[model samples]
Target chain A: MSAQPAAVPHLEIDGVSKRFGETEVLRDVSITVPRGTFLALLGPSGCGKSTLLKIIAGLETQTGGHVRLDGEALDGMPAYRRDIGVVFQSYALFPHMSVKENVRFGLDMRRLDKAESAARVDEALELVKLGGYGSRMPSELSGGQQQRVAIARSLAIRPRLLLLDEPLSNLDAVLRKSVRVDIRELHDRVGTTTVMVTHDQEEAMSMADQVAVMAEGRVLQMGTPEAIYERPATRFVGGFVGSPPASLMKLSRRFEGGWRFGEIEWQMEPALARRLDAIRRIEVTIGLRPERMRLVEAGTEGALAAELRSSEYLGGERLLHAAVGQERIAALVGGHLSGLPKPGEPVHLLPDADAVMLFDAENGERLDP
Target chain B: MRSSTPLLFLLPAVALSAVVFLAPFAWLIYASFKTQGAGSLLMADGLTVKNYARLVADSYFAAAFVRTIGLSALTTLLTLVVGLPVARLIATGSGRAKGLLLALMLVPLVCGALLPSLGMIHLLGPLGVVNGTLKLLGLTTSSIKFLGTTGGVVLGLVQAFLPLMVLPLVNTLSRLPRDVEHAASSLGASPLRVWRRVILPLAMPGIVAGAVLVFSAAFTAFVTPQVLGQGKIATFGTVAYQQAALVLDWPFASTLAVVVLVAIGLALILSAQFDRLLRRRRLAA
Candidate 1:
């Protein structure tokens, strides 16, 4: 972590943990979001991302630790007193109220003047680009439209911190793509310190300034998208952050200074070579991105012999599913790789040296750089 | 084929309804206009509004009509005052708590009206448990009169009609999304404000349905008032019973019955109208 004199973080989650009876849902999870920064709590289902978000929102209380907003510890404060706005996965719009009334709810609760509330409602509606939708009911709107109304309702309150939990998950694929952009633009315009929870890697990578990848009950990695993607600190993260995840292959130490797997020997980079002494048997898994693996013409140095298992024709790229010893791996080939070897045919697999990531097979931790 | 099969499934219910509901209602409307002895004691004999006219002129019948309406209104209000919170509690409580509370609420529902009245009489009547307790506590010198009073009748009606008011509201409240309350709270609304703006409006259908059901049940309550009133509190049903069974004026009794039926029918119509109006407003909003 760089010491850039962090701006008084708008929100701080310190050692926050939650348990439902005997089930530990969140375990000592902590995150900090500076003002106007978009932080995404990204994780697979049952990973406690939503639980953590709910705790920060005060919808669910943490069993231990604390959450602070704008420097005030949020102990014993109810969700309403916390003044944080939340957009739920179900949108949670008041089905009985009109769009305008729904937008004005928080303002009404605050006892703002009618004229002021109306102005804020209009402004927020326009911010979500649904200005003329005030008179409509949520049931009359499309799913995406309802989601925008929910966003507008929260934004109308002018909350300092906004939380969204899978707000775009209900939309169709095309709408999800477009709504992601809308959400990013909305965050920029509103400038609210925002925290969103999503399972979609693409959505998190594209929209979040800081992506916190969580698994089980803890955050495995938290960094900028590029940092989390290109140099994942953990094997779970390297496998989670990309679409066609990083591949793993088992290797053992050779009698020589290099590593050997099957009948092949490969020299390690200096940094990786030094760590080899600390590693007992050099039994390690090599992580490689599919895009990083190359299908070289036979006789290439530093390439392992393999047999093609199957091939898939993606629009702009062909994916070759091949096997090295009993381990299966995918390699992205050119769109016109019609001459690629058929299943059961011999092939050579080469790992781009710079792209290969090594993890301790026993612990699944990324080898320290 | 699919449509015809469903129609076939519906045919028996439709036939039963025509025989059970429509036929009786048609006969009641015809008998309302008939003369007393000339009418086939079981069926209509003549077409006349004389019985209705006589009912309008009779002061006893008029008072009973007013008392019936007033009792129904009071019972409905009291039931709402008691049932709403209980229903809300049952709706929001945990599964075990809801089941326990529902069972407690249903104790009154399953008890026969006469049985409850019998219980109340033993508890509230002169020299009964309440008077004895009051006397023992130094609150009273002697047993107090409770058997022949309107208060006893109203209390009995409230007990009899309470489940009708609560069940529908509970069903409605259970179906209401808890998200609205969470949304309101997240937006800085107080608990009271959330109930006022979100929960109450969403649960209106259930509330209205419960109120209507309570009012209808209390209006026609027979045994509770008869046993509790002990001949003093005269509601519409008691008046009809007196005229037909005691006074032997079959025509006047039938008139009172017809009037009560009309009033209940009007209430049902109003209930339907209110439900429709609320639905329309919901749609419009």
Candidate 2:
């Protein structure tokens, strides 16, 4: 669309839509992945992230629109001919085939010569750090090993695009972190245009170069992980993309100089007040991220009166639960800090003014400054 | 103590089978070794190998044995080819279609072999639906021979035993995750190759199970062959029936029955060995 700007995108999804009987599973979703970029379609369950991945992989056909790779339209190409590899959540290894055989299957389909096929199988196994595990059956391996084998099998094909559907969801929590790092490293080494669908924000943030946050069959925002995290396009994106997600509080009537949040009328900076004046709506939602807010003395200026309810020690940081008016918000404090307020005691929460976000109360869309 | 309780729960079933099934089978085996006097139908002499000797010496019995084996094999293959799609439909299909297909499949089994075989008579008789349609269409001037033919008997047997193949196939095929097939296709295997490399190999256990059931059912089936064969075709079932009921040679008939049972046992053992060999082949490959 940009008149051959730079290199063509390795994978392009153009206004794709999918409908299953009466239910619309995906609606006008589109994204493009530059070659070698790892993109994660991040969303909660039933968000159509997996459906979009399946459409890209050619595992499922889209009801409307087109998907292209390297400027070539792949509308009617069968999955087998698309040269896209998919690693399913279950691993989906041929229980009958050994590790080497499973990896060699794609090569066999291409009718590659035996020696080269065997060599590629060995190369793939080595890449996944399962070099000596060729003889082992899938059932014989642990969950982590099986997942690695699945990745190896997909990589052995040397596909133009690689799709993973919640690859680490089936693993136990302990193995998930290591596998997550391994997948990112593998993507880097292989340099294939890869798309991974996951609900785990940490996995998406740590692994993918670009993250697309989706909800209710539509993509809300698509950008670099930092961009999505720092400047979320919608209130849902703000609440969905972070650990201890940003808390949203309703804003009341505007006072003499600033708006009222909860029971307290907090004064706003002149620059921030000017931005709020742009929106004509009386009702607005303010987003305060837990990490961006801190505890201050009860009588501190420009701070909301709150009561400390509980604290959760998380190794290096402690998450404190505070109640202000009818709303409850959390703040992360240093674990080493001593003499924190006891539960039921009144405290003050001072949010970083620069980091504060405002959203339209009616539609949940972020109101950009 | 844990084992004893299971045995205790199994006692009635084992005892019932021992009384009703094992006792009759034992008697049949015993009778196969006994022979009647030359003039009387009643047993007169001690145990001997003459019935078995007579069996080995008879070319007619040998021909019947070969025919029955061929028929059973053909029936098994046909049922597999036909039942596979239907079983897949049942396994993957949802709601009323699956329930209806399963219920339809069970109709033959529930109706008993005799009823279906009797129904087959009207379908495959000289003036049956097929021949009548052929004649009415002017494809033939006269009715084509169906009764007392191998093809007719095979048809009847297939209709009767198809559910045997489908039930196990559905059980196994349904247990297969849809992901593996999707994975195969995404990994560059064509639809045909997916079936060859993934689906069929995985469904081998079901295929073996279904084949054993169908093959054994077809091999020892009586009513279908008797009613459809119309006395011209002499399968093991029909021949045994003839010797037992018409000729009234109980010892010789028992001998035939014993041989059929042994053949079924041998088939089961061979299939079990085949399963082991298949596992070994997969491992070694």
Candidate 3:
């Protein structure tokens, strides 16, 4: 509805919706990706994140609305003419093709001159650190190597927009990190506009410049990764995009001074108080990130009382578990933090007030300033 | 090195195969080399290659060989042309549609060779479906025919062997990952190109398997062409039946049977070789 901007978005999905028979897969969803930016659609399974990506790629048609590239509506175009690329989760490499052949297929489809196509194929394989893997079949390669081949094949086409569905989900945890870095490096080198869909919050937080959180066929929020984390627009967005994820506490009451969290009536941080426009609202659920809370000795000054439930050693940091009233909270601390607490031991947790988030208990909407 | 116990477990099946398949096949091969005789299934006189030589020299048998091979090949090709799209449709169809399509394809399979032949006669004979429709429309002509011709036999064979082609193709095509096709389309390949490059190459095993099944079934098929051809086309099966029953030249009939079997065997081997060559050229991991 807005007038065409000076610089048209690299890819704009406006009011896109899809329905399979009676079941709505994606509601009216809109997102605009700027050029040379990596965007991620993050959500749990059945969130319609993959469907949204497929719609943009023209792999899946939308029942309503349309997609635009550089301000030009791609309404009637087939996926083959969309000039987008996709890396499916299965890698989906042609088993009957060599890595080089797989990469060359797209270029061949484009009908580039043989020499230029070969050069581009080599360049793409090299870009994915698969320079010598050209003649190798997909089955001959490891899972990570095969994934690299898929990425190489997609990137070789130099698509207008690149869509990757759960790009790193098929890899092991350790390889996921390495491949994640590889993908970031590839994106930096190519500077292509890209969108990836993932269920892993950490993957989204680390890899994407902008993150769109979706749930149940609707996009809940879209912002820079940092903003999406620190200032989530909805309770689902807040709860869906964190390592331990921001915890939502149902049991809270306002005292004469401030709201009570779990067992103790605590004072609110001045910044958080200023952030909440509905400051007078009580019976609200607060989001406390696990890493933001600190553990101290029982009855410590300026800290609420808690009972230690358990503790888990997580390499560099220990994730200590404890219960304050009926709600369970986890606090990340170092080994040097007093030799770690044992289960059933009494303790106190001091949540960093600035890190605490407030939301309406009924609708799960953020009640921010 | 692993276990004789498991080998012991295979005793019944091995004995059954030896008696049921190997014994009859061995007897047939022996009978092919025997001297010509009347009223005997067993080999008589000394084994000789004279009957095979006569079979090769006889232009009648030669024409029959050529006709059978050419017609069977055409039937297999037509089966592929018709069955591939149907298999793909059934593969990508909804649950109920898929079940219905599968059930329909199974009709020919369960109908057996005899029933389809009879049905083809009713459908394509002189006063059958085609001519009857033509007559109703006032388009019937003396020059035109659907049954009692080589083309009719080909049609009948294709119908008979179609399920053999479709079943393996559906099994393979349905197992293909949908993402690969999506990947190809997104990568700027047209739908046709995707079929040619990605879908077809990946479905090679199914194609080869289906072709073999269809080719073998068509080559050995007796009832369809026999019924539909109405004595106008004499395939290897029909001619051998005549030589055995009417002429009672058991040795010559056995010779004809053996030659046709060899031809079918060669066709299968050649098809497999073609598949292996393709795999080597495009793939071979």
Error of 2 at A135 (Å): 1.6
lDDT digits (tens) for residues A1-369 of candidate 3: 233465788688899899999999999999888888899999999999998888888877899987999888987799999888899999999888888989999999989999999999999998888988888888889999998899999999988878899999889999999889889888988988889999999999899999989999998999898999898887788888787766687635555545576556654445555555355676777788888888766655446567789888887888778877777777787756666658998877777867877788899998865
Residue A251 deviation, candidate 1, in Å? Answer: 3.8
**Which is the winner by TM-score between candidate 1 and candidate 3?**
3
lDDT by residue (tens digit), candidate 1, B161-211: 888989999999999887778889999988888888888888888888898
Q: Write the per-residue lDDT of candidate 1 for residues A167-264, one digit (tens) a residue.
A: 88889999999999999998987788899999999999999999999998999999999999888888888888886777777888887667766666
Tell me the lDDT of model 3 at B229.
Answer: 87
Candidate 2 per-residue lDDT over residues B198-278, each given as its tens digit: 989999999999999999999999898988898888899999999999999999999999999999999999999999999
Estimate candidate 2's alpha-carbon lDDT, on a 0 to 1 scale.
0.90
Clashes counted in candidate 3 amount to 1
Q: Give DockQ: model 1.
A: 0.73
If you superpose only chain B onto the true chain B, what TM-score does each candidate give? 0.86, 0.92, 0.90
For each candidate, give its TM-score against the true structure.
0.89, 0.95, 0.93
Q: Residues A1-369, candidate 2: write the lDDT tens digits.
A: 123455676788899999999999999998988778899999999999999988888888999999989899998889999899899999999999999999999999999999999999999999999999999888889999999999999999999888999999999999898888889988888888789999999899989999999998999999999999888888999888788888888986665546876666756556657667788668788788999887887666557777889999999998989887788888887888888889999878888777778888889898875
Instruction: Please tell me which predicted candidate would have the highest lDDT against the true structure.
Output: 2
Runs in model 3 with CA error above 4 Å? Answer: A1-7, A254-278, A297-302, B1-16, B37-44, B134-143, B282-285
Residue A236 accuracy (lDDT) in model 2: 92
Q: What is the TM-score (0 to 1) of candidate 3?
A: 0.93
| Predictions in order: chain A TM-score | 0.93, 0.95, 0.93
What is the Cα-based lDDT of residue B53 in candidate 3?
87
